[model samples]
Target: MQHLDDSTRTELEAAAFRRLLHHLDEHKEVQNIELMILADFCRNCLSKWLVAAAEERGETLDYETAREYVYGMPYSEWKSLYQAEATPEQQAAFEARQAAKQEKGQ
Candidate 1:
């Protein structure tokens, strides 16, 4: 990538983040657990990282605000709209994965 001055690079990065968040919000059918089982990350993980990044920059932020930024709404609303019950197959796979992680001390 070509060099971007610090400010321009930062702005572009922030805009990209917002676009990603908007996409996530629009794709409400994509449950967080599905993201976790498939991608190893989810909305809650993103929110946690957002808070961590703010802290690293010496900005105080509460968890809920960070979560709202990531979810584009309240967590409960997102859950109602997007969350779904895991199928038996999903549950079995989750359990097997957990057992493997435990064996690895992850």
Candidate 2:
């Protein structure tokens, strides 16, 4: 990373991020809750980060556009295609992880 110029490194990083979003979008059957449980990040988080990065550079990236970028289409379409309600056990496990994360931060 230190050896590469900032622009090159940034381009590589953005490309990698795009690839990840593409993979996730292609596998829409994988729910955000599952991503959060497994990787501690979700599509929403990725979208938010994209928007934040754009804003940091004085670019005007709105939420919907960012979400579409992350989803590889409109979010509603993605949700309709693959989103599902989590089971109680899944919800409980997520809550437990959240609690543990918060505890660690303290």
Candidate 3:
């Protein structure tokens, strides 16, 4: 909020991010593709954003490490543990959604 000091706002934002990660972890059955289809972003997207932010700050943060941070374990482990193959219908819907976004220049 505009009334909050910078440090307080940053702390609150960081806390919210942590809570979001915790919530995602709690809902492990929710796949990344489903998130991308519904919300346009997923844990992997968060990881990439984290790396981009580090780069902007003149730091080097690799994708795998960033992904591990978001995933709470190595991404391969997370995939094996919780990720599922999208059904044919889900894949078709995802493709349509992506095409619509592209057409809209989103």
Model 2, clash count?
A: 0
- Give me the runs in candidate 1 sitting further than 4 Å from their true place: 96-106
Identify the superior model by TM-score, candidate 1 or candidate 2.
2
Measured against the true structure, the TM-scores of the candidates, in listed sequence, are: 0.82, 0.91, 0.96
* lDDT per residue as tens, model 1, 22-98: 99888888877777777668899999999999899999988999898898888888778778998888777777777
Q: Residue 100 error for model 1, in Å? A: 5.1
**lDDT per residue (tens digit) for residues 3-106 in model 3:** 99999999999999999999999999999989988998999999999999999999999999999999999999999999999988889989999999999998
lDDT of 2 by residue, 67-90 (tens): 998888899988887789998987
Task: Give the residue spans of candidate 3 off by over 4 A.
Answer: none
Error of 1 at 92 (Å): 3.1
Best by lDDT: 3
Error of 3 at 16 (Å): 0.4
Better of 1 and 3 by TM-score: 3
